[model samples]
Target: MSDTGRDSSVSSPEALRSSPPVPGMFTMVLHTHLPWLAHHGRWPVGEEWLYQSWATSYLPLMRAFNTLAAEGRENLVTLGMTPVVTAQLDDPYCLTGMHHWLANWELRAREATTRTSGEDTGFAAPEAMRAFGIREREDAARALDDFAVGWRHGGSPLLRRLVDAGTIELLGGPLAHPFQPLLNPRLREFALREGLADANARFAHTPGGIWAPECAYAPGMEHDYAAAGVTHFMVDGPSLHGDTALGRPVTDSGVTAFGRDLQVSYRVWSPKSGYPGHAAYRDFHTYDHVTGLKPARVTGRNVPSQEKAPYDAERADHAVDVHVADFVDVVRRRLISESERIGRPAHVVAAFDTELFGHWWHEGPLWLERVLRALPAAGIRVGTLTDAITDGFVGDAVDLPPGSWGSGKDWQVWSGEQVADLVALNAEVVDTALATVDKALDQAASTGSWAPRDTVADQILRETLLTVSSDWPFMVSKDTAAEYARYRAHLHAHATREIAGALASGRREHAQRLADGWNHADGLFGALDARRLPR
Candidate 1:
C-alpha cells in the first residue's frame, strides 16, 4: 500500500470512541543524527559534516528552542540526538574543533567581502556577494558568541538544559545509529542498552522513546523495544499503511509505533515540491566558491547554478511567511478530515532530519519557528510523540511490515548487493568481536559484584560497533562520500581484528598498547565495559 492508503483495519471503532474532543495532535519530530565523526577524518566528508551541522542546524535550532522555551512552550518538538552524535557533541576534541570551526566560518565570511572572483565565482556580483558576505560575517560572529556562552561545556549541558526546562521531549537511539534489524541479536541489544544508558549519563533520564535508527523496523523488534522499557518509537507512514490516525501497539506489546504523517510532512520536505525549493528561498546548491558562501536564490527549479538570481533576505522572509501559512492550513485540514474519517481527533507526526533546518535549507530555522508558533493559534494542538499517545490517539495492535524510511522503504540501502562486501564485513566482525570479547571477559572474571573493566576488550567491542554503523552502507549505496564511508568501516574493522587477536593470543602488553591508541582516537562512550557485551 502507498503512504496514503488510509486503510482502517488497523484501528477499530472502539479505540477511537474514547478520544478527546480536540481537533487533532501534531508533532514535529527532528531526528538529529550525524555518524560518529571524531578523529576519523576532517574536511569535505568526515568531521566537517559534524561542525557544519553544528553551526548551521544545531546552534540555530537550539536558539529557537531556547527562545520558545523561555516563553514557557513545552512539548514543542520531540528531538532525537543519536548517542553517537551526542558523544561527539560532548567529546573534548570535538568541542575544541567546533570552537575553531566557528572562528573559521567567521573568517571565511569576512574573506568573501574582499576576494576577487575566479571563473567559478564570477557568477557572483560584487555588491550582491558583499551583502551576503557581510550578513554571513555577522551571523558567524553571533554563532561564535553563542558557542562561547552556551556550548563551551559541550552538547550534554545544552541538551540537559533543554530537558530540564521541559521545552523538548528527547528521543534516544542506539550507539552509532546502527540498523538494529540487521545486527546480531546480542550485539543489537547491547548497543541499545548502552545507547540508552549513555543517554541517562548525560540527560539524567533514559528517553521513553527512540528514533529507531532510520525508522527501520523488523517484525520482532517491538519485543526488543518492550524489553528496553521503550514506550514508543517512530516508523515511516507506509509501515503503518497510512491508517496512522493513532499510535499502534506493536504485537500486543506496550510499545507504541507512531507512523510519520507523510501528507503533512511532505509539504515541507518533498523532492518534487516543497517550501525550501521556492524561488525566493536562498539557493542551497549555488555557491560563491571564493569564500565558500552561497549567495544565490533558487530562481527556478531548472535554472543553472550560475544563472540563479542573488539572494534577498526580505524575499526569503516573505516566502517563509507564505509557506508557514500554507503549512498551518495543511495541518488544520488534515486534522479535521482525519478526525471526521476516523471518528476521533487523529494523530499526525511529521518527522524530518534535524539537519534540514539550518544546515541544508538555509532559511529553515526561521520557517520552523514561524510554523511552530503559528500552529496553536491556528487551532492545532502540537505536542511530542509521547503527548500524542497520552492524548489517547492510539489504536489496535499492528503487525508492522518490515520497512525503513530510506529509498524504497526497505533495508536494501543498508543490505544490498552493491554493498555485499560491507554486509559480510559487519557479520564477520560482530561474530569475531563477540567471541573474542566473551573469552576476554572469562579471563578477566571477578568474584565481586562488578566485573573489572577490560580496556582491551572494550576497545575491540568499540571498533566492532563502529564498523557496523549504518552510515557506511548508506553512504556507499547513495554514493555520497562512498570512499570515506568504506574506509571508516574497514579502519574500525581492522582495529577490531588486530586488538581481538592480540588479546586472544595472550599478548597482554601488545593488546594494551593497541587499546590505548584506538581509545584516544575513538574513545566515545567512556562507560562501555567489556562485561556488558555478552547476552
Candidate 2:
C-alpha cells in the first residue's frame, strides 16, 4: 500500500481556511442496471419492472439532470447505463408499454379518489388516499407529457443530449450484465466489446469508463479491461482492503479502479441505516393494494405495516432537507480529515444504484438535487471520475483482492451454497452455447452454401447470455422475488438448450421454429450477431 503523507502543520480550522484550498474532489457514481426484462412477462415481475422504473426513476432522473445542465452544471455525476438496460429502454415494446402503463396509472389514481368508504381498507385513510391519488394523477400526467416530448424515439436522444451537454459522464458495461468474474473468458471479452459497441452506436460517443457489473472481479480481469479500451471502472471499497480513499491503478495496467467511499455513500444508503429509513419518508415495503401505490410512511422499524402512518409529502420534504444538510456536513468533514491526513487534496467517490432515487426512495431525487446544489454553494468541488483523475487523485498501483459489493464483500452471494445450483447451471449453459455456436459456424463454412450467421446460433447466444445474468442469483440470495428470478433463469437456460439441440441434430426447420419462438419472447438486442462470437 502507498503511504498518503500526513501533514500536521495545517491543523487548526483558521489555518486550513487561510491556506490555499486543497484540491478535494467529490464524484457521485450511480449504477443504472436491470436484466433484460422486455417481452418476458408483464404483470408482477417482468416488463412491469421496466415500465415502473422508467416512469419513476429514469424519467425523473433525466429531468433532474436536464435541469442542472440548463443551469450550466457540467459533469455533475457519472451515470452508468448498462447495455442490457439501454436496450430495453429503447425497445419499441417497452416504450409503448410504458406509455400505456402511465395512462393506466393515471386512471387507477383517479379511481382511488372515488372508492367507497368501506373499500379504502389500506393503511392510509380515505382522505389520505384522495390526496395521494391526486398527486399521483398529476405526476403520471407530467411523466406522460415528458415521455411524449423526449422519449418517443427511445431514451437514446435524451441520454445523448445529457452527454453532449456535459451533464454526465456515461459509463457502459457488458451486454447482459453478466457476473464477469465467473463468465467464460471468451464470452466475457465478447460481451464487453459488444456492450461498448452498443453504447457507441446509440449515443455516438464511446465511454472510456465502465461500471464492471456488480463490481465483481477476479485477478487478471484488469488485462481484459485494458484490452477492451476501458480506462476506469469501480469496485467496492473493501476490495482495496480499506485503502479506498482514492482511485488506484491496477498493477502495471493503465486502467484505474475507483473504490466506493462507504462512509459517505452509506450515509444515504446502506443495509442497516440510511436516509431512506427516516420516519417521515415513504415506506417502500408497505403499499395500498387497491391502486398498487405506496401510501404510508415508515413510522418506525418495529411498527407493523398496518400501523405505519400515512405518507405526507411535506414531512418527507422536511426530512430531505435535514438529511441533505447532514450529508453535506459528512462530506465536508471527510474531505478535511482526508486532506489533512494525505497532506494534499483527496477525492471522495460515493456510488449508489440509480434506482434508489425516485423508485425505491421517493424523496431520493429531491435529496440528490438539493445535495448537488448545496455542495457547490458550500465551496465543495463536485465532478465526475474523469475530473477527479485530471485533478491528480490517482494513487500508486495495487493488486485488488477477489470480491464484490455483496454481503461479506466476497463471492458468496453469487457462488454460495444457497445458489450452488445456479452456479452449476450457468457454467453448463455457457459452455454448451459456445461449443454449439463454434461447431455450427465450422460446418457452415465447409458447406459454403449459406452464410455463417445462423438464427439458431444467435438465439443460443442470447439465451445463454440471459441465463448468466447476476440478478437471478442475487434475487435468490435476497429472497426478493426469488421464484420469479429462478423462473427467468431456467426459462432462458431451457431455450438455449432447445435451440442448440435442434441445430446440432441438423433439424433446420425445428431449429428455426425454436429461434423464432424465443426471439418473439425474449428479444431485446436487435443488433446482436452470433457471427461475432469467437470461433
Candidate 3:
C-alpha cells in the first residue's frame, strides 16, 4: 500500500477510540562486531579488547536475552554477528584466553583491595577504587562461572540456541568486515559467500539478512546482495532521503534496504546528547591509572576527567528509568506521526552497535531490557526485520546513493584524505594477493592433483582479508589507537607480500615455514579454504 496525502496528526483519546489504531512496528537492530583480536596482542590494546567486550557486553547480553526468553518473549531483536567476530568467539585459543583473562580480572581486583588497605599507595581515591575493585571482582567471578557453564565449548552453541529458540533473528556479514563499496568486486563476493558459509556452519542456519559493514553501499550492491541470497540490509536514514519509516526495495531486486531511523537511534546515543551522557553514568574516558578502572561518572561535558564524580549505581539506574520512559515516548510518537504522515502503517528501525550497550554505556543492557518490556505495554509492536517484512512493512523501490553511517553520512571516514595511505595499501595488498592466489590455483589445477593443500595460498587470502578490515581506517581517522591499527594493517600486508614472494620463487620449504608462522599468528578462520576463491 502506498502513502496517501493525509494529515499526520493524532486525534484526541475519544477520537482515537473511534478510529482503528495505526498499524505501526519498531525493530531494534544491533550490529555485534569486532576485529579478530585473538593471537594479536595482549594488554591495553588487543586480546583484552576481546575479553572485556565478551565478559561485559556479550555475557550480559546473553543474560538479558535469557531473561526475556524465560518470560516467553521471542524475536526481540535483529542481531548481526560479523564473521570475523564469530571466528574469534568460536576459537579455542580465544575461549581459553578469555577464561584466563576473567580469572586475572578477579585477581587484580583482589590485589587492588589489598593495596588500598595497606597504604595510601598514591592512588586517586583508595576507598572508591577499593569499592570499584570489589564490585568488578564479583562481576568477573560471576562472568567466569557463566563462561565455565555456558561458553566452555565456545559462543556458537549459545548463539545457535538463541536462534533456535527464536530469541533473535541472526544477521551475518562478510569476512573481516571490509568496506564492500571500495573492495574489489571479486573479493567482496568471495568474502560475503564465505562469511555466510561460516555462519551456517556455526549456527546451522543461514541468515536471510546482513548488516553491511559500516552500513555502507554503492549503486548495484543490491544485485550482489541478491546473488548472495540476502533478503535485506541496512543503510543510514539519509540514504532513504530522510523518509526512513519503512524498508525500501533496492532498484528492482527482492533485497530490501532498511534505513535506520536516526531520530530514534541518536536519542539513545549521540555525540551531543544521549542517555549515556547522563551525569550519573560511568565515564568511558576517565580511568584510574593504577587500578585501570573507570571510577568516574560523566560529571559534565567539559569537566576534566580527574574532576568527574565517582560512579553511583543508584543514580545511573534512576537515569536509566528516565531515559527508558523518554525513549519509549519518542518511539511511540515517531511511529504514530510516521503512520499518520504516510496514511499507512509504518516501521521504524533503530540500529546501533551491540558493544555500545555494555562496553560503552555501562547501564545500556538494563536500559535495553526495560525498553523492550515497556514498548509492548505502551501499544507499540516490537519485532525483528524479518517480522517487519513478513508483516508487509516495505515501501516503494529506491535507487540508493553511495553512503555510510559515518561522519558526513558518506565514505569519508573509510576513504578520506586522512587515511588515503591505508586505502592505497589495502588496494595493493588485495590486488597482489588475489593475483598470486589465482596463479597458484591455476598451477594446482594443471597438475590434476588436489592431494596436498596449498597452505600458503590460504594464508595469503587470510592476510589479505585481515589487511582490509574497516576498523584500521576508522581507528586511524579517530586517532584512538591509530598507531596500533596502522601496525596491524601493515603487518598483514607485509605477510601477504612475503608469503606470495616465497610462492613465486617456487621455494615450497620457505613458503611452508612462513605460512606456518602466519597460521599460528593469525589463526581465527580455521575452516577458511583458499580453493573456494573464484579463479
Candidate 4:
C-alpha cells in the first residue's frame, strides 16, 4: 500500500495494529559536522571555527550528555558526527591544538573568576560567584579537561566508550557531506559505502541510519541508502508532502525516511522568531570587531554595546525555562491530538544540526539541558531514532522524490552564487584525482616500482578530500568567508591540475614542486590514505 493510504488506514487504532496506545512519541536527531580544518588555517576562517565550536558546543554539550547519563539518562539523544569531522577530531595535530585551546579557555575562565572576585559593589561583585555559578564554571573546566584527556587517550576510543556506555546513539552520514542529488551516481554510491565503512572502522559501531547532507534526497537514492546498511534518515517536512511520519521505511529500498515535523522544529529554532533570536541569547552575527568574539547584545537598532546590560544570567535562565516549557507542552499536545485523530499514537521526529546549540546559539546548551529534563517531567517521554525504529512503529515503503533541505528545499544552495564556480572546480578535481590514481596504479603494475605510485598517491588523495569538503560552496553561499572559499577551491584545483600533469608526463621535478606546494599550503587532507580511492 502507498504511504498515504497506509497512514490513512492507520489513522485510527482500529484501522491498523501498528499504532500504539498513546498519541505519538518524539525523537531528537542532532548533526555534528565541520570541515577538515586542523592545521589548515585559523582566525578569520578555518581552525578557529572548529576550535570555537568545540569549546562552545561540543565540550559543553558532551558534558551535558555525560551528566545526564550519570543521572541515568542513557540514550537521551541521537547524534550524528560525519566521518570527516570525526577523523579531524581524532587527528594528532588537532588534538595538540585542542589542548592549547583548552588551556587558553581555562585561562579565560580563571581571569573571569579573578575579575569578578576583585569587584566590590556592582553586578560583577565578588559575591556574584554563587555556588551554582561556581559549580557550572568548575564543571565546564572539568569537561574541557575530560575532553582533552579523552583525545589524548584516543578520540575514537573515547567515542566508543560514550557509545558503549549508552551516553548517545551514534549516527553516520555521507563521506564528505556531498549534495548527493547532483553527484554522479557511481561517485555517490562510492562516497556512501566508503563513508559508512570509515565510520564503522574508526568508531567501532556501524550506524543503521544516516543524516544525508543538507537532508538532500532523490528518488532511487533509497536503494543506495539501503545498500549502505542505513535503515533510516531525515528529510524536510515539505519534502515528505506534509506526511509527518516517523521511521517510515521506503518501499523501493530497505531504508526509511523520517520527515521533520515543522511544528516542533520551529519552536526551538526557525528562520525567524525562534528561541535563538531571543534578546537574552548571545548574538552570533555581530561579533566584537576588535576581539573577534561576541561581546554585544541583539539589542534594538541604535542600542550600543555600552548601553546593553551585561549578559543577565537570570533573564537567560528564565527564557530557557519558558522555551523548555513550551517545547514539552507542544510535544504533549501533539501526542494527545495525533492519537485522538489517528486513533493511535503518532510519532513526531524533530532534527537539527548540533552547532545550533552553543556555536550559533550561545544559550543553546543550557536550553538543551532544561528541555531534556523538562520533557519527562511534563509526561512527554523522549526517544532516539533507533529506539523508535526498533520498537516497530514505521510507515510502509514510499518512493521519495529528489529534494534537499537547502534554499527552496533543493540543491540550489550548493550550486548557487559564486558556489557554481567552486562546484565546477570540485568536479574537475575529482575527475583528475581519479584519473591520476588509475594511471599510478597502472604504472605500478607495469614497472614493478611502487615508490612512484605511492609518492604521487598522496596528492591525489589530498585533492580528492579537498574536492569533497562542503565548506568551499557553503562559505561562498553564506558570504561570511568568501575569500577563504575561493582560496581553498583554487588550491584544490591547482593540486588536481598539477597531479594530472605530472602523472601524464612522468616529470619528477614538476611532481616534487606540486607536492611541496600542497605541503606548504598546509592542507589537512594531504595525509589521507590513498587506498580509500575507488578501484
For TM-score, the strongest prediction is: 1
* Ranking of all predicted structures according to TM-score, beginning with the best and ending with the worst: 1, 2, 3, 4
Off by over 4 Å in 2: 1-22, 115-118, 447-452
Model 3 worst lDDT run, 10 consecutive residues: 1-10
TM-score of 1: 0.94
What is the RMSD, in Å, between candidate 1 and the native fold over all Cα?
A: 5.7
Q: Write the per-residue lDDT of candidate 2 for residues 1-44, one digit (tens) a residue.
A: 00111123313333333444335888999999988887778877
Over the stretch 417-526, how does candidate 1's per-residue lDDT look in tens digits? 98999999999999999999888777666455557888888898888889999999999999999999999999999999999888889898999999999998778988
Q: List where candidate 1 sits over 4 angstroms from the true fold.
A: 1-22, 115-120, 446-450
Off by over 4 Å in 3: 1-22, 112-126, 449-453
Error of 2 at 227 (Å): 0.7
Clashing pairs in 4: 11-342, 13-343, 22-345, 23-345, 23-346, 24-346, 249-256, 250-397, 251-397, 251-398
RMSD of 4: 7.2
Clashing pairs in 2: none
- Please write out the lDDT profile of model 4 over residues 332-403, one tens digit for every residue: 677777667656667887788899989888889988987787666555667878888777657777777777
TM accuracy, model 4? 0.84
lDDT agreement of model 3 with the native: 0.86
Candidate 4 residue-wise lDDT at 343:
65
